[model samples]
Target: MSLNSLRERLIERLTPAGAWTPDGLPDRSDYDLNPDAPRSPRTLRPAAVLVPVIARPEGASVLLTRRSDTLASHTGQIAFPGGRLDPGETAVQAALREAREEVALDPASVEVLGVGDGYETVTGFLVTPVIGWLAEPPVVSPSPDEVAEVFEAPWDFLMDPANHRRDFLEPESGPRRWFWAMPWRERYIWGATASILRALHARLYGDEARPGAAVGEDAA
Candidate 1:
């Protein structure tokens, strides 16, 4: 799709009043919460992230972060700019706050389109992914205490199916485990974050376009 068309579609998809469930997306049961078993009584704190997309002169790219190792959970994983929700804050407010804190991104420059479905993490946090369009590029500096690095990935590459790989690992006694992998340069994007991206791709594009296919190509 042309950039203009893509922007229009994204705006329509992000309408505030529209449905935000990942119903027609890939079945995340293989990766998301367990339904039959009772989960431990953990606090369902609302968390949010800014899935910021920059429409660069060359092409569109999505902002991402490499977390600092000091973090107790998901310490060094590749992720979006986000964190726990604070008291009296809405999901969008939390997302903007986190982005500003982690990456020095200006909240005023982001046009929040809509939010994706909430994904419950095994660690007990319910994360809401907020999709936003960056109106203008802003200077970004990573917070040494919370962010290891901040970078951008070509949206076309991420949206393509060819670059996504399904990998498995064998636990101590259980069968092999499965998860999504979308690698770029030295960074490996996987686990809950990858699952969220997969769902987003399915929603924006179609399911037939698996992950990994558009890695090296220009946007169609």
Candidate 2:
């Protein structure tokens, strides 16, 4: 598809911005691959992330960040720019605010298209992936404290099902845990980050392609 067509199709497929509802769609979770894992009913904190798809002449790319090693948790992990909501901020508001705080991405530069599926994390937070569009390559300055590095992954690579792998790890104290992992070059994209991308892939192209269908120039 041409760049314009790709952008339009994304907006058409995504849940409209500001129209998010927890009950509106099914939620993906860390336990998706672990069917035997016991799940308890509990309150989940609200969170949001900015899934920025940058428009480049060559192709689309997604904006991501590597969390700073100095952080208390999830150190050196790749993630979207976002965090828990503050006060009465909406998901879209928090997403934009967090992006600015984490990577110096100007909210004005982003044209939010819509949100993807809601994801419940093992850490007890319900995260909404807010999709944003950047018409040009963004100039980002990663925060030294919250973010270690900022990078972009090709949208085609991320949306390809062949790259999505179901991997598992055995812990000393629990049942074997399984999660989605998409390894790209030197970066190991997994956990909640990978899961969110996997969900987005399904949302955009789940019905359009047959199982094992190859990702091509137009399919991307």
Candidate 3:
């Protein structure tokens, strides 16, 4: 598909009022994406992540970040630029603010597309993904305290369902926890971030694609 068609598709998916979990998009394991999928009972805090799509002449790509290893939580993980919402902030506001704080991405450089579904993480975060479109790539410098690196991943690779892998781990005290993970080269984009991407893919491709991968690992 051409970039225009892809952009149109995103617009269609995001333009509606509260377009997050449209008919085709999957919900959290809490919302019955699968009855059998394990759900987290821990209290979930509200957070927002910016899904920044940089529109390029050749193709569009989504910008991602690697969290600084020094952070207390989710350190050294591949993630979107985001964090817990501040006092009385909307998802868009939080997302934009977090993007700016983490990666030095100017909010003015982004055109708000719309929001996507609320993704609940096993780590106890109710994450709202705020999608944004950038006419062109902007200069983004990582904040050393929060971000270890900032890079772009092809939208086509992410939107493709074939790249969505089923990953799971068996904890010593409970049942196996299954989550989506998209391994791009060496980086493991898994957990809530990967699931959110899968939700977007579900909305875009629906029944047109089939799953093609599974990987396993041990968890504590």
Give stretches of model 2 more than 4 Å off: 22-26, 210-215, 218-220
The per-residue C-alpha lDDT of model 1 at residue 10 equals: 66
How are the candidates ranked when ordered by TM-score, highest leading?
2, 3, 1
Off by over 4 Å in 1: 15-43, 173-175, 207-220
The weakest ten consecutive residues by lDDT in model 3 span 211-220
Clashes within 3 Å, all models in order: 12, 1, 2
Query: Against the hidden true structure, what lDDT does model 2 obtain?
Result: 0.86
Candidate 1 per-residue C-alpha lDDT over 123-174 given as tens digits, one digit per residue, 9 for 90 to 100: 6677878898885666899999999999998887677667778886677975
Q: Which of the two, 2 or 3, has more TM-score?
A: 2
Which is superior by lDDT, 1 or 3?
A: 3
TM value for model 3: 0.83
